[model samples]
Target: MKKLTILFLAMVIFSCNNQPDKGASDNNSEIASQGKIPKTEKEVGSNTTINDYSQVETEKAVEPDTIKTNDNQDINYQPADNNNTNQFEDNFIGFASFYMQFDKPKQTFILKADEDKTITCKEGTKLTVNENSFITSSGDSVTGDIEIRVKEYYKISDILLANLSTTSNRDILETGGMIYIEAFSNGEECELKKGATIEIAFPAKDKKDDMQLFSGNWESDKVNWILKETIPVDSEENAGFTFVEKMPEFPGGQQKLMDYLSKNIKYPTRAKESGIQGTVYITFIVNEDGNTEDIRVVRGVDSSLNQAAISAIEQMPKWTPGKQGGEYVKVNMNLPIRFSLGGEDFSTNNIDYAKEFEKQVNDSNLSNTEMLEISHYIFSTSKLGWINCDRFFRDNSPKVDFLVNIGTSKQVDIKIVFNTINSILTGSTSGGKYIFDNVPTGHSVTLVALKYEKDQYYLAIKKTKITREEEQVLDFEPVTMARLKAEMEKLNRI
Candidate 1:
């Protein structure tokens, strides 16, 4: 009986020693399921759990992904999932959202729907809407106050920041200007009533005779302009005399015209800083009423200098009317305004006198009598969205595709600015490459890349001449919002 009792005690002790601790087993199972390493009692502190200890170790083992640019700007980097295509598209959308803040604000006007109204914008665009002209999207008549929102884009800066391009059906266009108009009633979108039209008169200082009306079709994010109607021009104004008995003369003759240009043409600050100097050829018609009309830039160098030359020409006084067959007639005249910064004083009053004298001496070879084509773009439309005044861009150069490799999986917003034209092309991504197709070869262009991630703004800019099917690798650097704005402002001067 004593021996059996000892055996029983030994068996009990063996069972106790072989059995697992339920608490430790449960904790270890939980940690294994979470893909974390289980820690021993000695490794884990008194207050910390095994999962917590594993997490601390894992974090310490893996470093954060980051990139440092040449400017010493740090970018928090995240490797994009190659399996997810939507993530790339989402990144692009985010970039668009951030950069769209630079667009011009809409000018809103509240008007009674039952009353006729003539609204004039601060930029001199006139809108005339007849009474009861608004309808709901479902074709129901809208009464009460209608909200009219108008946004005008006259400057190249506005166009670039707005992500707008001058293109029609994949064909290039040279824009006179662009306007966006929308109407809302009761916080819902409204449309123009059928058979009721809104008249628009867009003021143009550099009006083109070939300018036509185009309606913008928004496909996704970009606008594709469709040729709509031909702007009508008066036959009388179009019948300017190329050869006349008495040529139209400036108010004080050629010398006075040269002096006026020298005194009034303010050299654009941006142009002076960039060392942009050239002659802008301005063409205008001196009408029978002794007034300058249909002013335009036949050839331009820089946008700022071109605008300055156009502005000076627009402010000229009435000239002596040309006479053809002993009757007052309209005549076309071309003026070449030279912009030079050879002297230390780069002020308007301190223009290069020698250059002006040389230009005057060469002016004798220019024809004073030429026929002018008139442009009167007054139009009535029942559609409201983006209305553009544009002409087809004529280029004889060979076209090629331009590709950009950012060497990153992150999506970016890309823009290609044509240095010589008022055109900006948005880039699209394919096979991890940003592509711009059919770009004119042998032209200077500025490539811009923008990104927004983790509340950080990044930018990259490159100016290059397109010679062939070229691929450029761009590296982006973090930039402050102010720096980004300043950089964008510089693109405006391109």
Candidate 2:
């Protein structure tokens, strides 16, 4: 009996020691409710979680500081607490911190969505760091902080377009743009170190869907992303598409079109002798039937050269029409015809042919037809004579300036016509100011401003006389919010 009692007491003591603490049970239940399991002591630095405590080599445990980095400011070399081993559930989100400097290591900012607060990070999240380089519109290497602002969250059901920032301002991140992202298993901020790199994953089955994971750093409105992975994406095609899946092609291809242009185009004798060598900009529509029509010269160098281009296009064979959403659609295309005097034409000439042609056109006092011919020649050779040709011949032409006042709005378009000796000169405004360089004196000019208020057209007109060699200014009434409201009220009554 004594031996049996001793054995039973030993067994009871063993069971008591094996049981989990009551506080621990409550903590584990809370963690499971949040959709996450706590990492075991052995898994602290493994690839399973982002908050890998193993990556942090602390000599001893210490209290962490609550330090906040300034948003949109360059982070200096101040290290935050790295010893925190707190873990987060899968629902938490991590934002990519695009550090301004190129050489600095990138970090991820973590936030608990349900709690709307920061979370602890673990180490050992798979990290794949790669050096990336980008060029700007000015051909300079990007060096500023790239800001990425999350405009809206579509809750994984609708399309999501994030606002990617530039040095000047934030613009919508374009679909199929280079920016991409992925999420890690663990979502915690403390896992990220000052210089540590993280792995990126695209968890979505369909990468083409609107919403996806973006993991990387920002360099002052410039995005220096290292990885892009997708989340679970819907299979249905997005409702709208701005760009076609496949662009329209010529019957034989682009090479064939080039060959046709080269074989068919003939230089006009007038244009050749006058040294008119430039590109004529032509725009046309390729119909759903693949036939080309509505050919016009948007920017002309010379009439003869423009005619040559138009004739070539009119004789072109049917092309392979563009398709949008699996159906053939009419597409507008722009083509430039180059009229260069090269290869057996002006190869041996000593004169600057282009300049000589301009001078010849300027010196001539010809009829309107002849003036247009010269204008066409100049325009085709160098895109120079797109405006009124009469100004080149008249020495003492009057000038008029339209000073438009639309109340701090530069989005309005202003148009004016100065009539002189059977010729009408059209001038448009450049940022609320329009200048008519050379107009014949003693002629009546008409000015018109078209303002659209809530899709309704408002026209303002003024008639004035032009004086020779003198500058004239005309101001239009400002379009104010009050005026627009009054106009809206009147339209409602009607």
Candidate 3:
């Protein structure tokens, strides 16, 4: 009993020593869990969680900063022959920054849907990033593939870069468009180009490496490049992949205003010295015509920055303008006007192509044919005059019309009349032979000759006006050819 008690006491002592200091250990554990203690495991966690939410929190530990870049001045880089540089800041967006100046790494994503869940990304419609990643799907597809090309910093002259900064203006991070939601459908193939949605989580960075790369180019207002899929994606309801939908300035989006302010609104030197690193949030009404009619501070920056920001806001062109339903309505814009100077400088091209267009117009004239006509005066002539109509030929006077047949199947029917002293034979075949002499001396006459078909004259001669009618051509040649005229004369002449 004594030995057993001594052993038990030793065991109890060992247990007590091994036992954690209840209060201290508990507090330490709590502190450790609270992230006061930054550990490698906490910084880069192993997401072996049964639930997605827990995994997401762990993944957020290594999340990159959500810094927003400025895009307002991007107009300076607009390609020639383009007009209205992103005139309306539409949902279609474009963005640039030092990060963009950095090399854009090719990032890929693949979703392995639950199984046999049919999800199709239609041609123009895109299934973009979702808020979470619990793909409830069977047949999954590549909803959207983005190849974010980050610009390398080499161009901005390293001299100024060291002074460049990641700003306290957190708004710069707002427009990273880093999150996306794709569509998972047991429904019909989702139409592309149409706005559609399905939820996907921004996966842990390691899982992102597992994303499949597809081939081909996909130009979205939000993203670009081929998915470059290495592995086939599965489609289930919540099993699909979710990427960052935070696409850079998709044109026609309101965030552009923020992006502009984030970039252009530098911290007033005075404001900075005063320790005001925060931004001024401005919300203005952009009318349907795309002008900022009213400017109000959603959050006041200051008198100097506020007025400056307001002036800048008022100078802004018409926005796409947000809407609650289908009607144009006023919306609030939280534009953070930071006094950041190290960001990119975007300039608008002042090269006026319109001036060039004006020059081109000044050098030339354009007119549509309004009226076209050829006046005709039928002349009745004697037998001898009609026979010598060929002698009165003219070339290209408005009075002479010859170019009836241009080529091949293109043919024009012609009509004409021979004017002589006798009005009796003025008209075609029925008029028979007529006589003529000299054309009026001062003027020229063209013989309006007709090419007869099947011995029947369809219309008046379509050649030219005959002017040599002062005398007569006693030498007569049959208008219908000599042989045919001879046969007619022999058979009918009295």
Q: Please, what is the TM-score per model?
A: 0.52, 0.29, 0.18
Top model number, TM-score? 1
lDDT of 3 by residue, 1-494 (tens): 11000000000000000000111122334433533321111122223222211112222211122212133223222123434434332211122121122212211223333322211121111122332223223434433322111111111112011111111111000010121112223322221121222211111211111122111111110112122112111233322111211111213443454344434544455754564332345554444444565567655546776776677767665555443234444332323343322222212122122223222221111121111111111111100000000011222422311122212211112111222210111111112333222222332222322222221221222223444333212211223222322332331111
Against the hidden true structure, what lDDT does model 1 obtain?
A: 0.61
Those runs of model 1 whose alpha carbons end farther than 4 Å from true positions after fitting are: 1-93, 138-144, 186-188, 231-377, 452-455
lDDT of each: 0.61, 0.33, 0.24
**Considering TM-score, which of the candidate structures 2 and 3 is the better prediction for this target?**
2
For candidate 1, write residues 1-494 as lDDT tens digits: 11000000000000000000121223444444533333111121223222210111111111223323323344344444365555433333334333344545566676889988877676766677778998997888998887776778877767766667777766888776778777777777788775666777666655554455687664435667788753222235374543344667777765566556656778787887787876676777788988888888877789998899888878888889977557897776666566655532222232232243343332222223121222224556667777886778778999888888855556577888788876777767888788887877888888878865543557899998887856888778877545666777887687
Better of 1 and 3 by TM-score: 1
Best by lDDT: 1
Q: Is candidate 2 or candidate 3 better by lDDT?
A: 2
Worst 10 residues of 1 by lDDT: 6-15
Please report how far candidate 2 places residue 466 from its true position, in Å.
77
The full ranking of all candidates by TM-score, starting with the best, is: 1, 2, 3
